[model samples]
Target: MDFDLTPPTEEMEKFRQEVRTWLEENIAEEMKESLDADEFTEEKYWYWREKHKELARKGWLNPTYPKEYGGGGLTGAHEAVIVQEMRRARACPNLSNRRPPETIMVWGTEEQKQKFLAPLLTAQMTCWQKLTEPSSGSDLASYQSTAVRDGDDWVLNGSNVFISGRGPGPAGGPDYLFGPMLTDPQAPRHRNLGYFAIPVRGPGVEIRSMNLIVGRDSHFVFLNDVRVPGDHLIGGDHQGWQVLSTQLEQEHGGDGGGGQALAPDQSVENLITYARQTKINGRSLGSDPLVEQSTEEAYIDSHIDKLFSKRAYWIHESGSQLAHEGGLSHLSDKVCGIRNANRVRDVMGPYGLLGIKDHLAPHGGTQEIQLRRAIALSHLAGSLNIAKVVLARRMGISRTQERAAPMRTSGAKAAH
Candidate 1:
């Protein structure tokens, strides 16, 4: 409920100005144009690589991570400024910038951090989470991947589906998986899970791109007796579940998901601009009462989404861990995703239905892609239903109490 501004430090304000200057000079027009391009051609890949390397060299890619490990070590406020600048420039984040190495940092050994964190954070390499197998979607505890101990090494064998990976942002194909393999069949349900740093290109590893409803591919990686050194195993032989939580934190937590997605201000600005220019029935959409009303509604929805997200971000930053309530962050995420979809469908209408590749439709800047991104984000990121379960447990309410309370009508009497 508190609305007082969390003032940025003088250092952060200066950093913002520096980032703005660099973005003005470095963000290429070609990269911006490719936002509407269909194919992830080779040239597009180069642009993505160049941008990532540019940011890496400038120490801007890993903002808010440890500075010693190739991160910017910037505060949350500075990160917000950087995200705002990127959205304003209409330059999408380099694909590497969105990878899942931070999870490794939290759960991996000091040696693991030294080996993978720097390259992953610096955008020198890309990583993906390979937890979701073909047979297991949400029930990860039941995964059948087996890693057997042999001398100082472990042999991994299993297949993971729906790995969200790309080589680079604009140019990269969805061709990779990132995470460790703990494929020990003999170990207990949770204990057998072992994390391995399997490279996507090794002899026993194979990745195939499976396109989704939204057009982007989710990699299906099959691991066949891949040999991994003892050092490559994350946090030892049976600590996979512990490390898994850390990775999940990155996916569900604030920074990774919060600032990167479509911002309210940016969405509102684009919607308003399209409304002003789009025409229907010989009248400018901006001037039409219905169109104007829809536009305002979209703005309001976006505003609510952003406001709740900002509140959650600040809450996390203010040294409080899950202080607001359990599942508050997840609730905000669902709201934001639904609100974004509504805004896109209502504001863009026929144009919104068209994919990013369609050049003939007006406002062809990946808005449709952005909408589907929200939906996928809502579903895959975490189950909203699971979130409610967590919240119910946190609030000390039994499942029956919570479910029954919602169904009670005014005329219904409670039984003792």
Candidate 2:
């Protein structure tokens, strides 16, 4: 197998230059300064929101999405160029919560797509996936959130804890939320659910910020008799498990057929820089064999994680059959993140624990945030143990027949 990096074509190079020029002319200095911030202020929030809208208007935000739905209608290579330029400028907008639009694209009726996907694609709305519940951690199929049909609407009543989104602050909360709900309790486990999207400001929907060790970005969302229009349901009733599996596949590191760019962990690089500059007995800390070894190990592990994601990206871009690759990428990210964080702490000593408020904190306390996030994210998406089980299932090691989750490509023909 050839492993050499292919140079971009001349036309692609020109497009890259165009994107670079646009960002240089448009991205504000204030946004660049706050790019590494752990939390967003009200002002920063609006700044990001407006900038995202600007990109959306230009079809650069979700470049590969269908043009009819407000995307750029570009190819995967074009999307890759946009992502590369955005990352280089350090102004990549956090337009996450992609599952809603993707699921809608694959399963929504024409009216549903026009109402929901259009706003999402245009950056007029932001969404959060309400999957995790107070009772169900990584066991998503066992969620207790229930949705009962009432005439032309669905009444949902349940609570989701540890929901990751920007809580109500200067910029306000998410515009919508989408996730699976128990539609048929008597049905079998995988066939008992239904997926729906509801506006966050709708009646009986409440969001409360949670005080966590790392940051306050997480929230507890409560839905009490929340009435959602029946048209909001995607993939039909009691077919949520199939629809949600597509989303889970993407969340667990599958590419969803979009050209994905690798965003390397800055903490590892920061630690290496610190070790080189730091002095111990008038000698560079990196000169110590133990410190050097730990730093090298961390860098190597992070590089491997990046490679895994790059491979997954290539697989999806090529439309090759994807199995166990996403699981491998996610598992490496979770395991290597914690391992690298420990290595950073071991190499930097107490300085690694300093927060952004500390005057002596290195790299604006980005390393500290990374260290905490490593621990927090281990339990997010899916726990490391659960990730292992998923990998085993995908690899066909846990069962005679491999249980590969179906992955639906957004904007592409429906796979179901």
Cα lDDT of model 2 by residue, 119-217, tens digit? 888888888888989888788889799999999999999998887775337225788999999999999898899998978887898888877765777
lDDT, residue 74, candidate 1: 67
lDDT of each: 0.62, 0.79
What lDDT, from 0 to 1, does candidate 1 have?
A: 0.62
Worst 10 residues of 1 by lDDT: 403-412
**Model 1 spans with C-alpha error above 4 angstroms:** 1-14, 97-99, 168-176, 180-183, 254-258, 261-265, 276-293, 317-319, 323-326, 356-360, 390-416
Candidate No. with top TM-score: 2
- Per-residue CA lDDT of candidate 1, range 1-416, in tens? 43324355797778778888888888777666355333555665667766876786676676767777777776667667777677667665656525356556555566767788777777766666788877776677787877788999878888987776554432233323555454666677767776667766567887776677655546677889888778777665677765665555444543325455324355466778888987789877889787788787776666655565666555444434442232455666676666766766776777887765677555665677667667776667556666565445445674532211100011222221
User: Which 10 residues in a row give candidate 2 its minimum summed lDDT?
Assistant: 407-416
